[model samples]
Every structure is written in C-alpha cells, then in structure tokens.
Target: MSLQGEPAHVLIVCTGNVCRSPFIERVLAALLPTDAGVVVSSAGTGALVGRPMEPLAAAQTERYAGSPAGFAARQLVPGIVDSADLVLTATRRHRGEVASLHPRALSYAFTLGDFADLVSGVTPEDVAAFGESGAEGARPRIRALVRAVAARRGLNPPLEASQVDIVDPFRGDETRFEAMAQQVMGVLPTVARALVP
Candidate 1:
C-alpha cells in the first residue's frame, strides 16, 4: 500500500513486448515523475523474451523520444505481474490474460485509452478546484470521474475490474502504429498525474 520509498512499479503488457508495450514503457518513463519513485517496465504475454523491439517500433520510438534505448522483448512472467503495483495492457485480451494469471492483480491492469476516458471527465473547473484542495481530495475526484465516465459509457471501471482494453497494434503498418501511439500518448499525462501525484 505504501508506494513511498519503494518505487511504484508499473508493468506494461502487449502481445509482443517488441512493439506497443515497449513504446508505452519508454513514453511513460520519459514523462512520468522520476522523483515520485516510480519505475515503469514492459512485457509481453507471448514475447520472444530476449528479442529486440521491432525495427519500425524502435525507429518510431527514437523519433518520438529516446527513452527505450536497447529495450529487448520480455515475456510476461507470473512474478512480474504479481509484483507490480500497476499493470497496463495493449489490448482487452491481454488484460484478461493477466487477470487469469493473477486474479489478485486485477486492480492494476488497465487500457491506456481508458485512463483517458477517466481524465476526460475532469473538467477545467474540477482541475482548478483540485488545485485549491490538494492531492488527497484530487484523488477522490479522479476516482469519481472514472466512475462517472464508466457509467455513462456502460463500461466496467478498470480500477474495479480487469476489463479496460487498449487497441492492439500488432502486425499493423507504421500508420496504424502511429495512430495507436497517439491514442496512448494522449492518456499518459493523466496516468502520470494519477499514479505519481
């Protein structure tokens, strides 16, 4: 419960760690707070373990940000899933896979885009109010917003269940990957704020 001192460990999941997951890992690592003591890592359910990221993904990552340098594909291990304080996946199916592996780990796995949905509900008014109140009140406000969005969309909240699935980009061309990356990047700020702040 106390993520203090001990780094807030996050594990990102994808079908192959060589692509989207690594991309996300790098992006989050670059953007998320370093002083918050959070560590971001990535893995794949069926990854090649020691393989390097896909060439296109690696190239795009360099162009986007230089954080994922020398990243090699890693297979999703039970211990990793169990140990992480947060687990994010690239697809709904990947969330399910993680859940099945560690049912107790359900609270952590969430789609990158779904977190955006939660953030969308936080209006400028809410942000201003939160700034005045402080971080404790801000957290409850964020949780409330997540619930409101989930109810309106009739989607189960990922915080309560391992259901939010991000769009998959496997085998897709550069264009599709770019689109997916955009979607993921859009939510990074929100996630960083929530997890680190």
Candidate 2:
C-alpha cells in the first residue's frame, strides 16, 4: 500500500530534541525505504537549538542501524507543524504543545507510542482503501491514514501516561538512554510499517 509521490512529512517532537525525538527520527528513517515518499524529521518544544544529538542517544541510534550523522536540534515552530502531514511527539505533553501551535494539527498529531497502539489494528488493506478514497498522491494517502486513526480514537481502552511517554535522556546515564531507545523502537517499527508497508 506504499505510495510513491508527494512525500508526506512526519515531524517528531520532544523537549530537548537532542535525545528522544532525534533518535526516533533517525531510526524511523532507517526503517522506511528512501523512496517510500515519507520524510521523517524532528524538533523540540524547548530545544537546545543547533546542538547535536546527545552522545548517548547517538550511540543508541547507531545500535539500531540508524546514523546520527549531521543532526542539528531545532525548535518547534508553527510553520513546522503546518508543513507536516503527520506529527509524532515524545509525550502527550508534546502533543498538546503541537496543537497549541497549530490547532488544525490535532487531527494528525499523536504521541509516538499512542499512535503505535492505535495504528496496530489497521491493516495494509485498510490503508489502501483509505488511499483510494482520498485525493491523488502519497500525501493524501497519509492524510487518509491519519483520518482513519483519528476516527478510531476512544474506541479502545485509554493508555496510561507511562505507556505513551518516552522519558527524556538528555542528562541521564547510559541505562536511561537505553530505556528511551527501547521505548521508542518498541513502537516505532509498527508505525513505520503502517506508514509504508
């Protein structure tokens, strides 16, 4: 069900941008094929602007087959949210921040783990059907998928905060960074598959 034109931009957000979001961004980049028409990027709600990814987080990125090369932290802005077709934030709090910046984004923005859970039950056929019903091109298909996920909200049990929020590992130890990687990677592969499979 992968579409090939009109790339869909996916923005990942977190507090510092040097840890969770960047790592998730790189790992997702690695998981998705280059021509999948899905572009993954990251930003921070309160960024350490222009800083490279935290050393430990970069290590985790490499461990997961994702390169940490040349990543620069950037602050989240209204324009960034407005440009994105999908937004996956590190926490529910980050999701709230995105909605504040672009009220319309509430339709497509989601916590990374929460999005993983919601999209898990959506099959490739479902995505194809969604794509068929939307306007032409990959971006429309992505928008269709987002609409489908949003429609399913509240049909399932609520996810606890701990289940969806990836903890910040900017100043934490190796173990903390490892936990962040574990939390993100656990759900992200499912998300990638849903986006491109």
Using lDDT as the measure, which candidate wins?
A: 2
Off by over 4 Å in 2: 1-3, 132-134
Candidate 1, residue 83: how far the Cα is off, in Å: 0.7
Candidate 1 residue runs with Cα over 4 Å from true position: 1-4, 119-167
Q: What residue pairs are clashing in model 1?
A: none
- How does model 2 fare in lDDT? 0.90
- lDDT score for residue 7 of model 2: 89
lDDT of 1 by residue, 2-115 (tens): 334345577889987888899888877777655656678999999978888777777667766646567888889899998776677777778889998889766556666665
The model with the greatest TM-score is 2
Model 2, 1-197: lDDT tens digits are: 55656888999999989999999999999999877888999999999999999999999999999999999999999999999999999999999999999999999999998889999877666666666554666688788888788877897787999999998888999999999999898899899987874
